[model samples]
Target chain A: MGAMDNTPIGGDTRVAALWDGLSRVMDPELDESIVDLGFVTDVSLDAAGRVDVGFRLPTYWCSPNFAFLMVDDIARELARLPFVREVHPKLHDHMASDEVNRGAHLGLSFAETFSAFEVSGTLEDLRETFHRKAFQRRQEAVILGLRRAGWSNAAIVSADLATLDRVVLEDEEAARQKPRYRELLLARALASTPSDRAFVTLEGAPLTEVTLPAHMRALRAVRINMEANGALCRGLLDARYGEAPAPEVPAHEPDHAAHACGGGGKACCGGCARQVSAFQPTAAPDL
Target chain B: MYTTPDGEEVFIIDGHTHFWDGSPENQKNIHGKQFIDCFYGYHSSLSPKDKLWTREQFAKYSADKMYHDLFVDGPDDMAIVQSTYLKDFYKNGFNTIERNHEMAQGQPGRFIVNGAYDPRDGEEALEYIHFLKETYDVKGVKLYTAEWKGESRGWKLTDPNSYRCLELCQKLGITNVHIHKGPTIIPLDKDAFDVHDVDHVATDFQGLNFIIEHCGLPRLDDFCWIAVQETNVYGGLAVALPFIHSRPRYFAEVISELLFWVGEDKLLFGSDYAIWTPRWLVEKFWNFEIPEDIKQEHGVDLTKEAKRKILGLNAARLYNIDVEAQKVRLKNSPLAVAAE
Candidate 1:
């Protein structure tokens, strides 16, 4: 019974650690992890401890830049594990699968990989763009939760990181939102000024009481755009694969504030009723 | 023409439609079937439960079905048929101009046929545009930037050859340029469908109207920002319109944002027929109301007049259809008389 007899579970533990690392990698557009999206189709380890992972997207024509990011991230994550001697990341059933897989394994950048095409910016530039959008999406969810819990717009705009953190810890709803929200906020904070407000625009402008409403409105569009895209991807993935992946989380619930505005649970205002009746189906012939 | 109880008439135009043949017989490979299957996914996901069509029906629906869907069974007064030729996928080319022109022949004035050209075809493509205009008298064209040809997966509007085509459009008197800039193509680059090129082209070709189909969706924010700055740019509501049912609130948000940025006059309604029916979409949109919160927050309004413009008037203006004259013609037409 030697202490060195832990070899049986050693490979399993390393694989589990590898998965943990991959979970941190997100499909930049959807802001969801590849694992949770059911994108990782296969994973294997050889006797030599070299690892291989395979993934597929919802479509044969998913954006290559985003595809490159995911495959590169997978290899990079596996490389960090001491026990893994070599990492092979494979992309399957994609339009550019050959180039992407070869490039990823050989450690070529996106521009180098697609030299035949005109690539305007580096992969980091693309990642940064999506990161900004993700930040806004995550921030909007947290703010919407706070507003539903009866926090005034003024109070939210004035709150600092500590205050927001306390709210996330104390409020059940906010706490549920904290995992994604705090994660994004922390990532952004590391790159900003020490005196900067916790919640800021993509340009690093602090939110104030006067600017809060406008900021919320703009971010609302970004949130809606992202959510709608996420829904479309889920639908396409289900269609392609013949079975929908179980959602890792409850679907991003719609804002409660919008629903609570009227007694009918419909968003239509007083003017809408009169306008809607004007073009009722009876106005046109029945099929 | 849809007549209100108060005797007010609303002209309806299905701004974007297609007569496609995606049957296995026509498919060059799995991609042909996959292309239409992708469309079917959208159809099944967003359509009203009762409106769903079988995969068999979707694969190669007859022209009779399309005509009835747009004219008799549906609410459209005039439908604009846009051709999308994916020669790399379909053997006869998916929804070619010749096919659209053939379908339009049976209906005459009831359909407006829009042709297409691939810049990758080079100078010969420009000559083909001239031939199409003279043969079909096409007033508009559909541009698929992400179409595949030979080894090249896609081309951009900013390309030299693409500019050559635009110059030809102006020379040929093709006023309306309908550009497809949404999801999926051979190459996987995000820029394959980037709306940025639209900005450059719209600025350069000020005379021709650039109708960004699907309103450059999945990039609505970017589209809006760019559209607001360009006077020649317009928004085509194809894939976006069906959302009025399955995702009403999100639909409201999309419409509100569009109204805020693109304004009602610049927005045109498109059924994206066959993928979706005009009847249900027209009905739902006619009855859609922007939530009070959204209106206040976005500082926008979706009034009945805005609905009128979106439903038909705006497109009528773009296509140069005199609505007053068309309304009179429809009122006395056999179909309207039969309905009465």
Candidate 2:
């Protein structure tokens, strides 16, 4: 399903737009959209374009730093919309719900929200840490898909963003994964320079043939940790909500051959391409 | 204890087990309710069908039920009663040392009553550790680094006061330091259960064996990396073992990784009982063979001896339980005679 298309909030374009905006806000730990993770429980907007979004994590005690980041990101994303007069984010069933909601409404910084505790650094530090992890995870998925498609480690490490994009577009298996990987790669790369090689380390060091194997191995651990966490969160969320949990976007397209029968050119892979395109918000709001 | 068809005896020691009371009467607030409910989620999701318990029973099962689950009906030769003193959540404290000690008193030698301490209490906690040692002779301690104390959500093992507590543990001869590094500690602003803190103390106090419970899960890779470096560090397979039933492939990956990184000698089996029973976990683990792919990838074999060590012997060595001697006693004991 398209990211924007699976809005549980029906018939209201305002709420739909709000949902679409919130969909961009991901649980940094899981690297999945809050909406798709069943975290965005309710979204509404008044006639005045004042948006109030309610969301919950898989558990009451999900990392407060992560919870704050999501709530803060949701408010910021919604406020970016020209129509949104004011944004109020409500976090329900969380340990720090009151603090989070109050802080978000008041536009309090994460440091200001929980001043009692000793926060080592700013929320950005935490975000960047997860961002680097998410980048590695997404990058690993693409690499795994490319490897399965018979690309050598040398070919993968040597390929630039443009080359990688072409490779993804040309291969049916890679094409199915392109949009999400491309979006994450762009997001991470754009921070330095869009022209910079996409498959660099968090420190912006480009991978060499020698480094690529070790890099992939290290990233595989990160991917497994994140994927296992995502699975546990989904299970916990399912138990908490007891509703049919939202179908997860497969972490990896393990069955590359099954999707390979679809023609390789971008045009023939319309179905998967459309799903990818849905994630690219027109506003291009900063995460 | 279980005997395989090959007539090899496998002594089972549930290295991590709890007797918690999350019943509404004991629950101080919604967090208490949420805490046990979260456990129930894991229980229902991972436990085999026949082994699963109702939410109500799981909330607060009886002492009799715990005994039946771990000793009478289950495969545990001896179980470590890991005390989790969540005073902030439960009225008297959820799964306090006192409750575990009381439960274990009925069946002596079947349990090792591990106590807990909050280093945040500082000197008072040091004294309390002495008190716990003198009263229960607690050979080990279950440290909840993420436990909330008043305004503070959690404290780290590397904290100044924590060092003092570790010193006391060394002084008091509490060698087995089982640190709880699983999900959801209060004051989530920090990574409360970060295994990094354990690394600090593990280095500082070489005399104390730090058994990281749940194997520092969700951060298993991190735990594995640390475990390899620290000879004194061990992995307690409480939450990790239950995955053997529900997610065997993932379970293989976890076990394979542990085998590769932590090695069989340092890994300990734990049921986290009441949430999960020892019966199925022990049985499934005995039957579980590392898939050829995983075995090949990690280049580690999950031999029967390895399973034997993980199930009990590793923990036995840590706690100084003589498995051979205990097995001999069990062989002649009335329980074995009655079973025969």
Candidate 3:
């Protein structure tokens, strides 16, 4: 769905673009794309360029702040498409769905929607917190990948962006996160230019040989927490919607496995790619 | 009791459980239904296929079923049934102390029912704590800080009113505070599941034990940091234990960190009944081992002794249960004999 098509305004192509746009919006807490998490159930478009996106969380009691942030990001991301006129993101079956949808429609912020309770800080604060966590989680994956690929601590600590880009990571998890890590690294301005150190603390401090172990320890915690939460969310979402992935088939029966779900290429988790196949939403009709 | 492959008996105290009426007839609003649905999601998602329950059975089960799930068919020596009075969501409240105490009355010495009170209720909260102590004689209270009350969505352990309630609890000899610091949830903007409040309250209420359920997951790092410094802080494995079945690798990673930081003596096992049964969770956890890589990385081991401690000894310590004597008592209990 993400592959760019040359056919402008074609019904199928536009709907694909709509999904691609939604794919870029992440669940801030889990730091995974909403589309991949199966939180996004449907996306429909009309001839007038108005887009309606429907999404649901693993539970009715998912954090309203996160629900709001995702809904807001959906509106913002979909509106970026040149063909899109208005974006209406609907959060279904949540405790604060009405407030979130109404707030999104009126262009209100999270604080505006639920102002009764005290807000610890701006939504930006929450975003920044998750951003730092995402950066750390991605960084940990890349570093662990490098170590597994036979890189020494000294070499890893001193490695620069150019060196990182040139090196090959054999580990699947690391390889997948390499681009994501680099993107955040560049986007957050943590590192820039070819010579910039590939690894740096959230505050821009470069890791030294003596400090790498402690840094890795901190990153490991962050990674573990995020991964655990991600698994829980996926499980709950499956249970709520009765959308559990197909039962595990014998590894020898590759043909049957592929046919049961779909081609194995779409799975985010390596080897068990079919595990996430049920989560992938089919294309919606463009009316 | 879980008898090991070598014939060693391992006592298990399910540190967290719930006996509630989440049935359609009990649901006061959509929140009640959704709350139970969310629990069902957790159940179906993580439980072994054989352990899964139908939605109707999960919504409300017979007391005999809970007893069978925790003891007769399960390995738990004693279960701590926690009360969560979601009065706003349910018609008669989710699981009040009255209901739990009543449930425990039928099976003596097999249940340690915990009471709950809202600190946001101010003076009434203190009064309720006293009432809980006198009426129920509760040695522990499960704090659902995210519970909704009228206009307010949630409260914190460090709130001024909460301090007053804790002071009352401490004075009344309620030594255990099982705070629900699991996944992050509602009350927009503020982190309803934040564990930082545990830091402050744990420090102040030194006499009380703060057992953060789900090991403050999704915030394990923060919880670990706080737990490492505070001797009184603990991590309950209710929500985390089910991971042993579905995501063993992830569970190993989390347990490795907890063993390293929180230590084996401070970690407790809980099945979070109705959501997931104890039988499968206990069996899987008993046989589970942290991978060599995770063990070495954390410089820790999930040895036989550690398993024994986490499963029962740790919680037994918190509740002041004389393990040897309790074991003897349970050995002679009517239910134990009946099961045999």
Candidate 4:
């Protein structure tokens, strides 16, 4: 798939020239040459040098802001050449979309088809995340109103996405309008899981440091909490090691709090200090 | 009704996470334990980005969503972080020390760093260990047995080189030393490794607050037996915990067994965050839908206090962090803005 055939465009210099022309018209968003990035799909050139070039949008339905920018770059570049007559953008799949492609293509050009206030999907993802964070943070309406009031980038990501479960937990009542909402609710439910073996017995001497001050680290919290709770069958081991001196290992930085998931390669804590291979299953869990 | 010193919540301590750049050229052989590829359920290639997830990315993604809500700066949060790459060490020095020391540093009882040491470097590794403590104020030290004189990429925490580093961690006050354990005799000898191989060495280094990296295959009870039997030894279920088909009760068995063996305090909190935990939780919701009550049975509290230790505190004390001052600073510390 990598090696490309440098087959010439044959006799028509315009066809070869059109191909050469679009390469320089690169996809601005990707920041790479368009031809090499496989964005330029097809190009047609007539004897009059009328060029019709087609391109696949970076996304299935990418906003055509960059597409039209390249369209103009093509027109200007081709118009500058001695032979070209007309230049038109030929979008194959994206332009035929239900909301965006068909709605605007009638009176508007591809570039003009976009809405200035169109909602960002990533922002929407962040919005949903903020809701979950608000609940986790107990912030409730704190930041939602901030975003609603048009604030800039600001958020509190607790726990690792690795430890978080991205489930749609919204019930039918709340999710009747938006089905995807259910998935979001379920995502954090997993977090409530005990992180270590949740020690219920309270056997150890009243904890050495009963209350922790506020200024702790902020690594994956929810997941670690869930993992810590889940990993525990009893409340806690005795703080006093009968024979063993305390490791006396000083504290480093706190990892993000509230995340329930772990990642690979970039795994934090060398795979969170415990990695059990699935291939070698142990005593079947009771859960 | 709900009141403990930490209050309602468990002392949440994360006890695990690594900070490192994917790039190899940070001038650190910390361990050629190159985190190359990971295979999870045969669908490893499903991810859009091929890069392995790191604590930084984990933090970047999870920061605002969870951290701000869960932690209050002081003992409210605790994390024991380790660095695989020497260049990737945490910049914060000992609690209230230089914020940019760039090595393993335990903050005002907040985030704590455990610097990685490669035994293959021999004396040089030992020297760096000293420098990390003396110069950077690194709190804890980390070593990997499988990483030393690595066999076909790796072997058990029981490996000889790992024992040497473990020797150092015990000698030093680096109690939070983490050891990695791969699958037992990975059918193809090429990938064969056993965490138990170093069991005897760990026994010899008794009293060092040692954590066996991966509980070495959750469902398997062999290592659990060792953790139960060993006096100074403790284990963490950082990865490969099956949460999907298993309900919260299903996990109780291993949790119960781990508690029965190592006792609860010895079992540190581990999410194996970037790699396994998130998906397991997702799959748990997808398949089992375990109830929250089931977790409470194990003494797991969803409230804020318990959240502190599991988040990082258990490791903090186990790591022997100064809990006394960490509490005072939380109220006055500027790093924390709001805490619920």
Candidate 5:
């Protein structure tokens, strides 16, 4: 119907089969299942059991790092489902630095790194082709920028693409980080989302909690810590946006370890704004 | 060939246009408008020979003389703009305009002039824009290649090169990006000049306004689509229409298409005139088939009234011109002493 229609309604046999598998994948940052978080916006089940699943992140042009990771996680998780044959985690719109909007597209169309299928010879060629294809895109970005600036190809051909490449990345980062303000903002956010005692304990819960007779008392104390931090974060925007204390036995507290981002990296518990600029803008404004 | 219906002298307001007349030969001995501290200058590809449309020449030139005025009917009001590119090409910027202003303002609702600012000129652009707004009663701005494409993209807007230009524009509340775009009258695929290039800086300065030049044909798809996608961005339409009708046509298309898609009211008409689309060429565009939804949204007829709005009312509004109530100001106020 519409571009955004994505509900699993009536007679969807394939989605019905793999629904449980899809629901299990979590958005590493938010420990809850992605489906529960409404991340799985659309699900399609084919006659051959080919499943295509699409979802959106909170923001358009979200980080490619986690986006790719999220896509891969779904494919891997669904591969284990009993009747599932082929699974494709389609992340409709994502942010990638190189091309216009083709990071995952390149990843899937070329690398096939997100798939559970044995890599095909065609996939291998496509991956190599992506790297080659990138050369043309690079040329396009550089040439287009120069031509607009009044430079002819003959004039800029001798110019190094490396310089253009650097300019592109540098220029982009400068825009995103609000070079004039992010550090100040980061400092402000850090001061706000400081974690609580319970969140840390809950994160460190024993593996046995899934089915064992482990330290339920110590774990529940952690839950109390979580409630307090939850109140603080809910009470204040800072807790959600600010620097969450560390995840470890932080004489400090880590925000929510469940979904603060990065895989198993203790640093992730730091919070979203804590992300070091993937491409830190180095241009200092001329004050 | 077309008369303003029964010689009623048509309702036309060139909401956006530019001027660059050198200090007059007749006023040679007397002190001239060029001596003012806020003198203006711009980098333009058009040579001096092309820019010498005298105030007298401009005042008398029938907008219909140019072979391009057949598209749209004229508006009841007229607004003018400065050429961010052509200032230095002819004479000093403010000096050129002072004379043109003297000649152009004689017609009651026929003209509204904007100022010019080159971001590379830095604080000077801001300083002058401020002065033009308060002192000269300049209604908007004329941003050329160096202003938007230059500071925002090339030098990187993050550098304060263009940010301050836009910051000051936004702070003063101006939204005219008399911006130039397209296959650089040169050659190269530099993404810096691409139509989407502005998205980088534009995202940062959300409130500051724009009127993308050449109707953003360099990347018409993105430029037009962005109008729908990005509500803050408005595209400017004008220029030698006999040769560049595609520009206004595309401008209307982008405005109409975006109306349906992104569904926002953010299109403004700019006749990068005098050098480009003197009234004649623009008149041809007055009749370009505007979409019904757009006409309804703007609350004007499907044709003439919509064209009038496009030619003047739209920019007048974006540039903060109150079409109706503005007529009541004191006779001594700077703008009142001149014209609406």
Candidate 6:
């Protein structure tokens, strides 16, 4: 269920739930799930309910702020799990691994974490900027999908949330991003009700037929930027950790025993060893 | 020079290349090792399988390999070898002008060595710019804004100290300013990757040409806006060009956007060598085309003339090279003679 696992199917709900939590956390800049991006390498829950999440980014020098955001998000998301007592998101190999891990553990704000660097802007501002981009990128995908489905620019710019909800896009990318776009759109209050226009600028201004072409070009720039960064992130991740076994896991008999660490299970054995080493109290920082 | 199927020779001026020793022995700390490893990641990731190099080879290659990779074997007619002195990361400094100039000495006219300076060094930075010009007679300088210096993670082009350095560069006739505004290396703040700084610098230093490397990807929208507003601004195709192999469609879309906004005359070819070679990139890019729909949407086309400009003509113009004269000189060079 997690990035490290060679198999797709697993029986342990506890560990799977941990992965599910990690999945909710994103790389902020890319606005993609950490799990989906192969950032989360190992997830294991001990008997004491202490969750240690092992992860690595595409590069050791990835922005420290982005690293902090992801690590902090991981902890926050995992805390939602019912049985999870404590969450430790272990970021490995990154230049800021120590600061980020310690900061996440102590619940320190990004400013407090690296106060020495004199971070110029607040993480909230950075987060907001990325939110706007994610909204735009996803919106572009959905809009392109509609355009591909033979919907005119007039139809798209004039369509309401009700119309968007009922849309059955044939385009795979648009269809996949449609719901995600809706979630962000509503979250950002760009559109709130069924009667609200589905397509609106990040500032909540509704798109007009005359402005649609220019607006689409603007959206496309955002889309292409995010897509390019996403591609680079995926490529770097694969290059950093020789490509992970195919992301898909095969469904088979649910072997509960095989799920246990050191129970001779191929999938969890390496993960379990890594878990033990990662959580060691005296684990020296690997340079 | 890259010869087309019809036997038309296309001169290539690779806008970016590096000669660095990121080997363990040179690494001052973990950041050093990780820095090169990250570059290796980019190398292994975007490069075709057959183009892959072993980690050891990538970490440190001989001078002969670099020359062959750029000239005798690769398609680059003239490679701009940019110096990046990560004194904090490597013991002897990574890819300093000393090393680049040493290598360029062998090839002479085939290499254009660009110098780099850390503005965070304050008055010393200004002195360093003078020193670069005095020593290398450099016409261009590469600014790696994300480079860490002591306690500072990065600096902006708008920084007061940086402005002073730019003034020195302007006076010294270092007309070309290549800034690394691509993906973050060790940035603590978003300002490092922000193209807004380029906007400010380009507008202020109208006399200098500002080439935003990587075309400020992930911030392409902002970069495009800036490039359109400022005529002196240009885009380097280092990190961006690799997409020709890994994501040709995305490359089409990006190139279309660049053509529409930055224009072919403002774009330059770069292999960002060692990470990727110039041979395959030049071949692939020459043959590539923006999808018809993208062309229509962007109202631009990647014409052969545009390709000729992007491949080398644009850069030759920036460096004040007379293409015909330089071609004659390069043809008579020792390497060219050896190849013949």
- Scored by TM-score, the top model is 3
Please state the error at residue B249 of candidate 5 in Å: 9.1
The DockQ-based CAPRI class assigned to model 1 is: acceptable
| DockQ scores of all models, one per candidate | 0.23, 0.27, 0.43, 0.01, 0.01, 0.31
lDDT computed for candidate 3: 0.83
Give a tens-digit lDDT track for model 3, residues A1-287. 23433223466788899989998899998778899887787887766677888888888889888888899999999999998888899888888889999999999877777776665666787788889988998898899889989999999999999999999998766887899999999999989899999999999999999999999998888877887787788778767776644243222223433321112444222222123333456753221
lDDT of 5 by residue, B1-340 (tens): 1244435333344544544343353233211232110121110111122333434554223433321221223232445645333332223432244655564554444455566666667777778778876866664566544322321222334446677777777777665655665322211112323456566656777776666665554244456555655556766544312222312222233344334433334545554454444444444554455444435533443355555555556666665666555444312232222111
> Tens digit of lDDT per residue, candidate 4, span B37-122?
11121112112123234433432233332233224322234455565542222122111223222322323445666676766666
Query: Which tens-of-lDDT digit does each residue in A1-287 have in candidate 5?
Result: 34323433336454555666766664432223456444566667554555676665533223333455566667777777655566766664332323312433334542344223222233233223223222222223333345446755444433432343333322331233232222322332321232211111112321232322123222222222222222122112221122222222211123322221211234332222222322111222121
| Interface RMSD per candidate (angstroms) | 6.1, 6.8, 5.6, 20.4, 26.8, 10.3
Error of 6 at B28 (Å): 1.2
Task: Kindly report which residue stretches of model 5 are placed more than 4 angstroms away from their true locations once superposed.
Answer: A1-287, B1-11, B21-76, B85-100, B104-110, B147-158, B182-192, B240-264, B275-283, B286-308, B325-340
Which wins on DockQ, candidate 2 or candidate 3? 3
On DockQ, the leading prediction is 3
- Residue-by-residue lDDT tens digits, candidate 1, B145-258: 878777666778889999999998988889899988877663445454468999999999988999999888877877887899999899999988776775565677788889
- Please provide, for model 1 over A14-58, each residue's C-alpha lDDT reduced to its tens digit, 9 standing for 90 to 100: 667877777777888767667766677766666566677778887
lDDT of 4 by residue, A160-258 (tens): 222222323222211221222223333444322433211111121111122211101111122233233222210111011111111211111123211
Measured over all alpha carbons after superposition, the RMSD of each candidate to the real structure, in angstroms, is 8.3, 6.5, 4.6, 23.5, 25.5, 8.4
lDDT per model vs. reference: 0.75, 0.75, 0.83, 0.39, 0.41, 0.81
User: By lDDT, who's the top model here?
Assistant: 3
User: What does candidate 3's lDDT look like per residue over B173-240, in tens digits?
Assistant: 99999999876345556775568989999999889999999988979998999999999999999888
What C-alpha lDDT, on a 0 to 100 scale, does residue B228 get in candidate 5? 55
> What is the descending DockQ order?
3, 6, 2, 1, 4, 5
User: What is the Å distance of residue A185 in model 1 from its true position?
Assistant: 5.8
- For model 5, the chain A TM-score is 0.35
lDDT of 6 at B188: 86
**Residue B2 miss distance in model 3 (angstroms):** 1.7
Q: What is chain B's TM-score across the candidates, in the order shown?
A: 0.95, 0.96, 0.97, 0.64, 0.60, 0.97
